[model samples]
Target: MASTTPQGLCIHPRQMDFELPDPLPRHWHGGDAFKSHLFDAMSLQFPDGERFFIDSVRYFREHIGDPQLRKQIRSFIGQEGHHSREHQVYSKRLRDLGYDIDRLEGHVQARIRFTQKRLSPQRQLAATAALEHITAIMAEGLLRDARHLEGAHPTMVRLWRWHALEETEHKAVAFDVYNQVCGNRSLLRRAMLMGTFFFVLDTSRGLVHMLKRDGLLWNWRVWRGGLSWLWGKRGIYRPLLGPYRDFFRDDFHPWQRDSLELLQRLRGEFDGAHQAEEANGPVPS
Candidate 1:
């Protein structure tokens, strides 16, 4: 665990410079119909979500008085903005494909209202930290499990891969921000909020949206496959939970361990593959 002092919290700005590769898969153009519907529902509540993050940074800047932390928050906001833009494009393609983006977004907005009216700021921040942690873990898992995705839809894999890379880059930002804002808060409270919010709201919404789009909500195969993916050796949830526990431990620093090494290896593999393809010249179509 790294110390939480201002001096110990610095993150390089260059870490956020990576870009998505060109010629992305076509299937990803229309979105993962299932996930898009779910995301549409989720995005409805935070209509100006990119602005919400920017506002949060403003709040932190006025109250926190930490320049480094503020810079990190801004970088996180920028990364999130990029994500929002890309996802919006993907969702639009889904709408063009005949999915009900408006209806789904409306339902998600209603859910966000319920959560905002019910939860306190402390609880909300805790939930944000937990969700960010999960995202970071899943990002790593996707990079690790690239093989499972290789022969599937290239568009889906490319979208997820680009997402995973960004997630890894900003993994520490939200948690660091939450800790700075809520000094000396109990870890138990954070853990409780994470479990409650994720299982009750996030997972429920995702499952419902997945079912609505795929018509596999009642299908055993979908259930089995989803559960297996979630709980299996390469699953995101299991490995992520361990880090969640570490997050509560006394000495945790985002930079303490070299978790980004896996990311480096994945990048190397991608670069090598491109080079090999170039060496092979044009293949017969």
Candidate 2:
């Protein structure tokens, strides 16, 4: 099992720029529009969504008694801020592809703003913890299966692998903050229930729009490609069912499912890849 101790985690905020050239296909992941749009829709929310995560945790910084957790929170904020900036560029690239990405992102921001105005800080913090769990599990799903990202744009794969690894690294920061400040299991569970609904609803709505725009909404082959990606043993989400249900456990913690070995393996893989790139001639700016 992964250590639940905060001291074992290293939260680093990396600033990265992925050059997804114009030559890349609209269906960047596995060359399937459905799969690509599914991720694209999720990317649309990351910039503002990450800002909310940062704000929610920082709001209760005064309540934290542990110095280690306080440091982790700072790292978490820095990491999420950089993630937001990177994904903003990613979502904008979809706009350059003629999709209505900005409009969907605006809608997502509107909902977040509405929640901020109408909800209690405690509830907002609970919502952040809940969503963090969701992302952690989704990240786990991706990291577990190397083949899950097979045939994706190389830069997109690197970007997502980095995101997933960091998500694993700092999965517990917000939840730790919420627990230290305002953890009501019943209230957190309720927020998770509703949050799950809206998360799916919003992503699906934007995905449908993107699919329609790509003229893939009615394409049977496109949907088959999506089904193949989302169903069966190879599916990224099928394993998430167990982890997602674990969120409702009485003493739930993101570190309960130990995938530290997987993290270690990927870290080595990515490190060696980066070293090889460095050894090569200078990459084009």
Candidate 3:
């Protein structure tokens, strides 16, 4: 039997560590606009998503009557709510820059309604877990590729970095929940659901929107850059994709291919910076 203790799901919310740059990058000008658009879309998507999941919890609690699972569901909802709020603030910054976020928001609402109508709670959770897994992998990949983004806008880079880090931190929660709730479900079915959600809904939507907004969708330069980044010498895609693909296997765990060593290294660097500040005494206000 799986453990239902709160300790099993304990997750620490780390403070945002990355610094946003002052001036934005040139290549990222339109991208930032798109991000603003995307963030608004996420704001719309997340609340509805959260409500659906919360309702799922309520449904399960009534049927299964597991108090521990109920608490876990609440924590998951809280984390997602925080994500929605943060992204909403970030989206407002984009709006302040004069982007039209309303249309983007409308599109998101439509998508959410479509998803709600089409999927069961189990499949919805499966999709969410898959997306979370992808996000986690992308987070680690971005950190590894931060140097490549050096010439990009600082604020955009910082936003992506912070988003990536948080994604990595909470990657396991949804999957764990999905596994716990969907008892006796085959891993193969879960894997197929995840792949379909990402490839069809998430990735395809992102690519189409990006292309329409930036005119870079079919551009060889953008394609080359993306491919190079994903498959290049220092590419993180290989390691990142491994665990996700293996998720269909009977032995899969959320942490199976985790970049734990890298995570630890980054944590050490963060701690060391704090120690250095302490050693130098408090700075003048």
lDDT of 2: 0.80
lDDT of 2 by residue, 1-285 (tens): 222753455565555677765554788887778888888888888999999988888899888888778778877887788788888888778888888877888888898999899999999999999999898888888888876688888899888888887788678888888887777889999989988998898799888998999887999988887877787557768888988999898878887777767766666544555542231122211
lDDT of each residue in 1-285, candidate 1, tens digit only:
243433433222222222333333323324333333333344332333433444344455555566666566665666666666666665555556554666655554554465557865555555556556655665776677653354545555565576676667667666677677774447535654654464346445644654656566677765565566557776545766776566566666554545556655555433455432221122111
- Assess the local accuracy of residue 263 in candidate 1 as a C-alpha lDDT between 0 and 100: 54
State the TM-score for model 2.
0.90
**Ranked by lDDT, top first:** 2, 1, 3
What does each candidate score in C-alpha RMSD?
A: 8.5, 5.1, 7.2
TM-scores for candidates 1 onward, in order: 0.67, 0.90, 0.65
How are the candidates ranked when ordered by TM-score, highest leading?
Answer: 2, 1, 3
Clash total of candidate 2:
0
Model 3 weakest lDDT span, ten residues long: 276-285
lDDT measured at residue 70 in model 1 versus the true structure, 0 to 100 = 59
Candidate 1 at residue 175, lDDT? 67
Q: Which ten residues in a row have the lowest lDDT in candidate 2?
A: 276-285
lDDT of 3 at 256: 64
Model 3 accuracy (lDDT, Cα): 0.52
